[model samples]
Target: MQFTKLGAFISLFSLISASALTFTLGAQEKSCFYIFTEKPRTSVNFYFAVQSGGSFDVDYAIKNPKGVIIHSDEKQRQGDFMINADEVGEYEFCFANGMSTFAEKVVDFEIKFQDENDIYKAKMPVQPNSQPNTHVEGMQTTIDNIDSQLDNLLKALQYYKTRNNRNQATVRSTESRIYYFSIFEVLLMVGMAFLQITIVQIFFKGSRKQLV
Candidate 1:
């Protein structure tokens, strides 16, 4: 089958940094996915990568429940693809070296989800009780959620959107610190001025009294 190649467009890149890839709990809106396209046709190519030192083999179909096999790369050309997701839902893509290898092989993939859309394919097969792949999918979900959070944070910083009153809170905190520090500085200067005046008066008073 002909997998959709990222249409006539600019080359895109999405890096799932170590921190961006791991978040076992908390928010579910953001997630990150690593995808490798042997013949990438769409910017939305979806796949998953391994964690830490363990390298993984590649598959050309959906390896997880929540994901979909949107396309498959048969040409067997592998490269990095960055995904920027705007919606949350099932996404599908795959990695395959069957055209070449069958042993303990290692491949890296990056999938970008714009909004809360978090779905990923697992390199290994599913388990009976615990899903080895679910964890990777979950990590991708967290990363996707982070994208949204990061966007909101950036907007707040840029004054685009005043979300969660974050901008106001930051301004208030900064103002409070500056105000207190300024008051303390002024008070210190005033005390020094008073001390100088008192010393001058004491010295002059002694001279005047002796003259009188």
Candidate 2:
């Protein structure tokens, strides 16, 4: 019973350890976050999306503890990456909004760290000695399956959220462009009307002067 309880606790802790953050980046600015690992061979999962921005894109980079660039991209709107930490220390993730001059960018990101030892322990074989051991093994398997499904669902939701944000930004930009175009069209029509009236009045005055 104690072993079962301990397994449950570890699973819960692993899931809860995932870190998520949402931040705004000013024009031509950069932001970075760090994650520390105590031991080598840890697995890291990273995900990021630009919720709203000028072009729905930004620059990003991930560096290892030794300052070696493990991953980098330019003009990316969203991404998902998994990497292994061979050296134990701090890893840096950075985002840059240098392409935008006046627009601020809103970004959402998630980071997950998994210890190899815990993973191996969770997958260890069950001895064929007692019924209780078999039951605990089955329960752990069920929990792992549930955790995987939950992760997939979360990723799907994030994808949809990114799509929604992009559509909204598109709608707003189109609306503003249409508004400006309408104002310009109205001003041009008004100027033409004024010019036409002035020309007609000049012709009548010339005719009157000729008769005088």
Candidate 3:
């Protein structure tokens, strides 16, 4: 019965948590996402990482409901930010790759919103309890602990995924560089050999003419 309740709580937490998303930005392109806050003083958490592409960096901007830029950065590889939503409207988050002329970028990000009222309401009540009530309270505490652990696990998984993607990209870029360098080396050697042969032939021809 305890395990069943814990599973249900975990499911609920999953539904409430923000989902991670992947965004591909073409060269000189900008992408934006909108988040709405119904009440003032809501907490918004923004997390992002550049998983691949040139230099693994991008420009990011956060705008409030009034279309004013509140937070902005340039050539950032990753960021985690918390914003206080003071206005009750749609806020905008944007990512731009204007610095890159031909290299596209792959970015992973997530946004989570926590309302003060919701947090307050979610708190379990503690009061003078009989035997049955005490038992129920203890079970609720265990469920809460499990939920917190699961959330941490989810975050760890996301971090690993980002690292893996970046490593793979690095490997591919290195291989491409090596491949092109090898081709260039071969071409240079062939050109040098041809030049030497031509020089030797010209020398022999001039000598023969002189002898004649």
Best by lDDT: 2
Instruction: Please write out the lDDT profile of model 2 over residues 177-208, one tens digit for every residue.
Output: 99999999999999999999999999999999
Estimate the TM-score of every prediction. Answer: 0.27, 0.81, 0.82
Question: What would the per-residue lDDT of candidate 1 be over residues 153-197, giving only the tens digit for each residue?
Answer: 843443322222334545666899999999999999999999999
lDDT of 3 by residue, 66-100 (tens): 99999999999988878888888878778999999
**Candidate 3: Cα lDDT at 13:** 21
State the local distance difference test value for candidate 1: 0.41
Best of the two (1, 2) by lDDT: 2
lDDT, candidates in the order shown = 0.41, 0.80, 0.79
lDDT (Cα) of model 2 = 0.80
lDDT of 3 at 106: 96
Worst 10 residues of 3 by lDDT: 1-10
RMSD (CA, Å), candidate 3 to true, equals 8.2
Evaluated at residue 129, the lDDT of candidate 1 is 92
lDDT for model 3 comes to 0.79
